[model samples]
Target chain A: MEFKRLNIVYGHYGTGKTNFTLNCASALAKRGERVTVVDLDIVNPYFRSSDYHEELKRLGIRLIAPISANTTLESPALPADVYSAFSEESGTVFFDVGGDDAGAYALGRYSEQILKSESWQALFVVNKFRSLIALPGDAVSLMREIEAASHVPVTGIVNNSHVAEFTTPEDVLAGYAYAKEVGAFAGLPLAATAVPARFADSLQDKIENIMPVEVLVNLPWNAGK
Target chain B: MSERVLMKGNEALAEAAIRNGCRHFFGYPITPQTELAAYMSKRMPKIGGTYLQAESEIAAANMVLGAASAGVRAMTSSSSPGISLKTEAISYMCGSDLPCLIVNVQRGGPGLGGIQASQADYWQATKAPGHGDLHILVFAPCSVQEMVDLVGKAFALADQYRMPAMILADGMLGQMMEPVVLCEPGEVQMVEKPWAVTGHGGRRPHNIVNSLFLTPDELERTVKERFERYRKIEKTEALAENYMTDDADYVIVSYGACARIAKSAVLAAREKGVKVGLVRPLTLWPFPKQDLIKAAEHAKEFLCVEMSMGQMVDDVRLAISCSRPVSFFGHTGGIIPTPAEILAEIEKMAGGNA
Candidate 1:
């Protein structure tokens, strides 16, 4: 896998964007990098990177998240520390974007900073298994939607297609062509193929830039794998 | 249908409604249920269906009333406060004997509460959705798949009974992602609505869809007739899941998201040799008193768990005629009660009785 100084991850709501962002943050921190995650998708009440503020901190990551989340006043108010993602410049920073165009609208305010950043790659995650983006064209259109909303152009494509915990190496392989098609459609590179960590070794030779993933943003009640 | 796909509960319900032939969706965007309306906004236009993001929840409900009166499957969904706005129209829809699907993906509430999961709307759905002697068929789904399944079931049953049906989901179920298989057997027969205001021409008499029977006796007659339908629903439509309750001493009663947590607690209690099981009601309005009463014959006590302070506990107590002690354990204001906390409550009840 390649590392950029700043990574902007965006996708349709159920396309596993938050999971990938959290995984990348944890991976970067584990590599002894000073990692900070800008949780810009405050509108999403559940399964956002901000929900893992404690978990991210435990993993030696700094999180600039929404202030009034889960409170009586759940306004999508970003913290003042959000600007530090670009200003600090010492470590890797990731923008865990909101799900869709509506979610991406929040990032429009920080477009100038995001554009001025030295090295940033907006990763458009595509899940073929998800309902809306079952086609490569749909995936590319959503990428454009996010880009239009945030005033930020997407730079890469991530094939994060899976059927939740029931994902298989074959499922990951089956979605490879769809990912490549999406990348081709968007004129972008296939940034990474997110393979479930358990099946990553078996699928190592089959896929390039294999980013092994684990299920983290799961409901507490849905405990078993 | 064969391949399961990961879908948020809101999206699944919206898709399920479309699959069940509900071509009209009118709603206002409200968390954590905005996804459902968003889904409809994207899909309905493509499928030649009507998807109107109304100016307000009141407007949305009125649009649904309009759609249903045309003898079409129609739906409207909202969160707690938005649902409150729609309640007046819900009452009118019931008064007119219109069939439609109303979805309340509940958030914490007394007024404009936080955007998080809470089952506080139990009484609102079951006892009084609006006013008058009216009871909308309320379906409480426990899982994302169940939420999808209930959309079809609710629509079919609503048409069959000529009354509105509600899917009383909380934010947890609305926002959570799960692998779901959309199942629409499409076998259930819908009763014909000859009374629908479909605009009969000069050849036939015009049908009027009105709630105002100005004369008290006429209103009373309609109310009694609606009650007769309610009695039939109570007799036939109550749905419940009895998990490991065949010989359990302590039975846990729950519905919707609380049922999922309570089932987990029941499993944990069983590991400690606690004779505990769960009775989860799928239909909250029908109340499933028969299952509760059946459990009471064998179980010595019952525990009612909820995300609210404890509204459903009263229904549980009433259901079993207080034959056994019905205790309540809950958390309110968008806080979900954990399995451990419920197990602790069950253990205390188990020991207190012993």
Candidate 2:
């Protein structure tokens, strides 16, 4: 499997969805791969990858949005420039979907073409702790539902199993294993895993080919800290 | 020549943001402000900028914080509930003295209020957004033209003061379609930011971007300094517009969409014997205190008409110090009052029946 196909990370609220996407986007961008991240989560009020627009821009990754004036925070639609970038044979693109199934439903319209286009991998992120859906069976069902709705299949799964500020490499590994089993049963690949950003780099040996989140924030960054 | 184009307030802001050289945006989608986000999504990428519909409003605001810390012009927007969620982040921006733009498309409520327009957020916005003595400069746009012009001003004031500035609008402002001049992309000036965290590449030590106050005294000091900046802002940025106030007997004080409605009321009252004028505030915070006070002296009574029950009425009473009979007539929960309603209120108040 390509280590970095155009990856998509999505799930319900508080499920370590952004943690996974940001880590992957940061890691990919840091590795000198041109990366583009679209913040498509229209529901929930926090914990999204779009919060790192400046950081991504500084890292040489292009950001596409409708924000031109300082006070204009209106998330209109995918700007013409984003499609231009997508049209070019470019680096990895990470589209972060919202937490609720309703938010996920929004992707059905805007991202249908992008999802069906070649080399796009949609990774469904899940955390067992949250009650949106539990058990591998439930996750698979949710994935199938999302795929049917968006006309896009979940290419893989990532287990973000832990409480905020309390997640460890072991928890991540356990979640990864769970995700792998779900992926196997769902007929999708277990693409990757996510360890909290604070886990020391020494823990990198705990899991191979996984993403590491640098920031562990339970709330959205709007609070500035 | 300024061309008139029919466009939504949010789209106008998008066009203005681009014209003003503000190329960064981070936000989650909320009602009444969704058009803004939708517009950004469609335009940002085409112009070599960034747009992301954050997983949540919190994430969207932090994305703005990150971009602002990097010294690039950035913004996040939402309605009242969304702004309530963003208080923690907004407080931090104030504490850090990080210049940024925050747009609150005012909606009704203390909770998940209806999607229609209301200005119930006057207190939360003017009050310290979070726990601090810090003040956020609030700009209230009265029309689509002001939405565009104020966006440019929002960025400039943000950079100049190194403070967070807000465009306090309502759903009416966000959804209204009005004729506006399309500013050429290069004409608007961009603020220079030297304090952005663009990564320390051996040129300087790592710059920590945060808003933590471990010590009370330290936090207090930061707040005091922010207050100093606020005082300076108050002196320079207080803005208001007067309409036919001279020799008028009664004045209508309002802002945002309500102000537009009140303007019509003034004309309607003028057709009658009631000499009514207007004192429309452009900056809701640091409000047009002096002008309101001055207008109160000439006008026998001040009528505060709003979509909300009495949000702006309190501000007028506070500003005028209850010098005149400040009567209020309004509706709450997304009910828009017509100019006729306001004119009736003016007539009643003028007839000494208020």
- Top candidate when judged by TM-score against the true structure: 1
Question: What's the C-alpha lDDT at position B352 in model 1?
Answer: 61
Going through the candidates in order, their DockQ values are 0.55, 0.01
Candidate 2's displacement at residue A74, Å, is 19
For model 2, residues B91-173, the per-residue Cα lDDT tens digits are 78887879888899987787887766788887787875777677887898988889998988888888998888899998877
**lDDT by residue (tens digit), candidate 1, A37-110:** 88888777787787777778799898887887545466768888787777666489888888888889988998
Model 1, residue A152: what's the lDDT? 89
Q: How high is the lDDT of residue B254 in model 1?
A: 89
Regions more than 4 Å wrong, model 1: A70-72, A88-90, A222-225, B184-190, B352-354
Chain B TM-scores of the candidates = 0.97, 0.94
CA deviation > 4 Å runs, candidate 2 = A1-225, B204-206, B352-354
Question: How does each model score on lDDT?
Answer: 0.88, 0.73
RMSD of 1: 2.0
Q: After superposition, how far is residue B151 of candidate 1 from its true place, in Å?
A: 0.7
In terms of lDDT, model 1 sits at 0.88
